[model samples]
Target: MSSVEIKVKRLNSKDAQFKQTLLSSLSLPMADDEAIDLAVLKILAEVKAKGDEAVLSFTKQFDRLGVSTVAELEISSKELEQAYQGLSAEQKNALDIAAQRVRSYHERQKIEAGCHSWEYQESDGTRLGQKVTALDRVGIYVPGGKAAYPSSVLMNAIPAKVAGVSEVIMVVPTPDGARNSLVLAAAYLSGVDRVFTIGGAQAVGALAYGTKTIPSVDKIVGPGNAYVAAAKRRVFGTVGIDMIAGPSEILVLCDGASNPDWVAMDLFSQAEHDELAQSILLCPDAQFIEKVQASINRLLPEMPRKKVIEASLANRALLIQVQDMEEACEIANAIAAEHLEICAAEPRKWAELIRHAGAIFIGNYTSEALGDYCAGPNHVLPTARTARFSSPLGVYDFIKRSSMIEVSEAGAQTLGAVASTLAHGEGLQAHARAAEMRLKK
Candidate 1:
């Protein structure tokens, strides 16, 4: 424990005002969204109307790349290979391992999730089923403003490749023409077909609307700044987006048995993402909560991103004392955190009660950081309670399902009248006639 208090909010579930307080605290401030959206709208419109010329102009303005044409922005295939070959032995091995693991997991997910075309024949000679096909191409926007994320390239591109997408296009801003070698190496490893040195709403617009150099993609994945999020939201209909992700979040539901230091670091894992990120702890053990707080104070000062972690903790972090393990699970469901860690004596037992988290980490050793990197599961999870309805980014996002129907003469004779009646009842003569025409004369 340090002499300085961390000033993270403390709450007790037994209090009458606890739920209200917790819900209020969960709402991250959204003061700048309107401003960001307005700016993104202009960028999207410009890209839609002007295409490559607009992309080049915006790239010049934002990234400070004075390239005369959009073609100059595309990172060559040879450059990608060079990026991979130039890595140190350890870095190359790590990238290979992570890439292999991600590929294996997604390949398994493809098979296990039944991402295939299937049909069933009925006794009436009618066949009905679903046909699954991969998206032709996709664009992944890896945020390049704050930091370089080689992992994002692996996570986003690997799944699309596993799903058999024909092409994977990546766009990352190279501010002042500074490119991250690791990101390029990961892109090469993950089979990204195209890399463009561009970012923000302009990059999103270029991908969605299709500039002369950047072909239009069927969907866009990966994370970005506020402008990117707003741009994705605006162009959602034109191209599919993974999700409008919010800040990183981790909720650790721990029992007294787990080490307080381990638990504290787990919270820090998410808090270090940025000041807006949220780290929460739900524990029935009040004494353990105090121990964790002490550990946080002791270890926080040593973190490289100490200031970020401190602000995140002070802004949105929570150390809630629950009545028991059961209550903690209940609250965990309510929160639907992006990452949930059940660090308890019987982790699976507690995990069974969790239904809404984007991802669940069991046991004290299962840190969220592993999921963010080498862990097979895609770290691009739902956030801000979006996990309640949405799912983590996966191969399924890159595949489309089409309903297959082969109606036999006899089957159509029996079904056409039902359809005609319903269509007529809904006041549509054309629809009714279309169905009636299919009936046996």
Candidate 2:
């Protein structure tokens, strides 16, 4: 089948203007200092000083549905047992299946120690190898305000566990002190050692600085709101953070044979995420483009999240009939979408041609939704075109590496003069003399 085709149609200036406006609207949300920042600072200071008392106080002040003590923060086996009872039989089954798939996929990212040996004689012998090690602790922030995402719990926690982090802690916000049974279940199953019933910048501060109630973590990972992102930004130097993630995005590249219904639904999946979420379709078929637009108009109203989808479509959705697959790939790479679905016949072939994307979904049935939930891939991905430079959360994110070197007396003596010469060239008398002394001995 031919791979190139050019479709020319007048660009919608209004649509173009809308895309520009939406892209510019990527600003982080406003946080009042008196309301949020000061509160966060006080909580941070209190946690730093008093520890558990501060955490419990903030929990009561903010998440005042029922939790009154730190003990309430811990999820018990009884909670997990009841979680299955609350879920419909189908929902429970889906969670079980998704957990297995996600776990299985991430297990492949585990690494082992290896040795490299080499002998060189300058005046001595030397050997060098590199070793990788996991961190002592990691903190994961799960969004629990707008909705419950058990999948996120699995995606963030599984990687750290696989990386062999000594301790894994999770922080979640409960607006009215309501915990999602499924999320708690996922946490329990994922080997999370401790779960804190706190969130926002304060939660980040507690994790970064270490509180009496919550132990300080080495690195923090997960997706969150703009305030959460800004807080992560604020606390970056004190503690390591994964990324300052932006809104969710998806770009689908399709051929003339692509199904309009499928495209429409795929776009809806990202659109429903948030008003700022972007869903784009780039293809060469004018008919297919028009059909997908019509399908969006038809199916959007029928969905319960029509208002959110409508806002997202009006603000961030796009339908560009590009010149060809080559042009489509160029535009997709430029956008660097969090999710890229290639619905072309040779999806794998086309996927290889692309260079920038957080995750690539292939073929018609391989929709972005699968990656979001049960696909066994990390859903916490880079957004706002950062995928060009960033990668999805994985076992690698939780580990650190150090280079090892061993110099034999013979190797050091053989190489000493060269090292001394370079050190002397840099005008470092101490360094040169140190190597020279070793050589002399």
Candidate that would win on lDDT: 1
Q: Per-prediction TM-score, please?
A: 0.97, 0.87
For model 2, residues 39-69, the per-residue Cα lDDT tens digits are 5566566766776677777667766746656
The pairs that clash in candidate 1 are none
lDDT of each: 0.93, 0.79
Tens digits of per-residue lDDT, candidate 1, 276-355, equal 99999999998999999999998998888999999999999999999999999999999999999999889999999999
lDDT of 2: 0.79
RMSD of each: 1.4, 5.6
